[model samples]
Target: MNAEQAAFLLAHALPPEARKDCWQRKFTRAHRSDLKRLGVTDTQAERLARILPAIAYYGTHGPSLAAARTPLVILAADAHKAAAALRVVLEGRDEAMQESRGRLLQAIESLHPERCEVDPARASFFHSYDHREPEALRLLTALQDVEQAAQHAVGCMPKAQTRAVAHTYPVELIDAALSLDGPAFHVSASAESKFRRVAALCYVAAGHGEPLRAIRAYLRERNASPEN
Candidate 1:
């Protein structure tokens, strides 16, 4: 056998079970035909048979000495690299959660309070406090307060201060945040109505749209009906 083939034969020869019983042998010897195929002389074949060996009892089925041992070291190294890659991916995902948190907060603050309707009952239900502030604060408070829920929706505690965040925010991200690049509106409604729509869209994008919309809808319906 060649040097590489010889190494494989030696590396895989000994089974642990064979170690326990010396009589138990691991055979990896090339057959006469195998040596013939390799153009091995009878003397060379005899030498190969002597060194290349295997145990008697094994998995019961396998290739003859012609079989090459697995490249386990390379495989192990690859697996280790793959594991590290996954760790990096997980860390990045956590960082993204932080970024999302920061972005959502920024979005709330950026929203002009005078423009939106922050329904008091909805805000109170979410915040568990009596905040009658306009829609911007209510929405901001909602994002701030729902830490656990945000982590669940986003996958972890969210990101940095405004200045660092501002550098990160590209024009595309801003457009996406506002959906300003989405369908343009010809608003004939009040400022509150227009702002409420924007607020709802933002909250929805933050992954907590259900509760936000529910409250908004309830308040709208309530407002539409005459007070008892």
Candidate 2:
């Protein structure tokens, strides 16, 4: 089938209620399960899974990461090469980035429930993937990698603060930042009280930085964005 036809079929295949509840709300493994049951191809599911967090983040946070530009630039200047990499994605609207973000948003829009499907009780709930599932195991592995990378990023932080800092932000955000793809720009300055903490950590973990110097810059930028 053609693109429009594929989109329509996908939309129609989804439970009326799941379409409604997930539109601008939280997405979970359970939602991913729904997509699979509806026969969404592995290719489609993986593509969607990779960027859904970014989509959800931007939906809740804001449309753009404009405020983070200066912080990212400063972090880059401080020898955080990863920051520079992420900044490039944010600043430039390359074809790949545009197409990826566009496709994700379109898919989400198609899944949005119609007015009649708004009631939660109408949607059947299913168990999300547990540790036993291959998908869950794969995700577990990826998260383990992210945690290890985050440790390097925050390695310079004090013994007392490191754990808290690492635990606060979602791993999905860090993964997005490091990928140097669509979600890289989805990291928002306003989303976290200590956005720079996670941002700097992602940068350092991704590579390049005098940790002490980078932390200083992150703290300095924290107050500059009053909205955060």
Q: Give the best candidate by TM-score.
A: 2
Off by over 4 Å in 1: 1-5, 8-12, 19-38, 42-44, 51-55, 59-228
Give each model's clash number: 13, 2
Q: Which numbered prediction scores highest in lDDT against the true structure? A: 2
Model 2 ranges off by over 4 Å: 1-29, 61-228
Query: What TM-score would candidate 2 get against the native?
Result: 0.17
Q: Count residue pairs with overlapping backbones in model 1.
A: 13
lDDT of 1: 0.35
How accurate locally is residue 107 in candidate 2, as Cα lDDT from 0 to 100?
46
Give a tens-digit lDDT track for model 2, residues 11-127: 333233334434323335655465455444445445444433333332233223334344444443444454444334334488986665455434444554231233444335584
For model 1, residues 46-78, the per-residue Cα lDDT tens digits are 332332222122212333322222233344445
Residue 110 in candidate 2 has what lDDT?
57
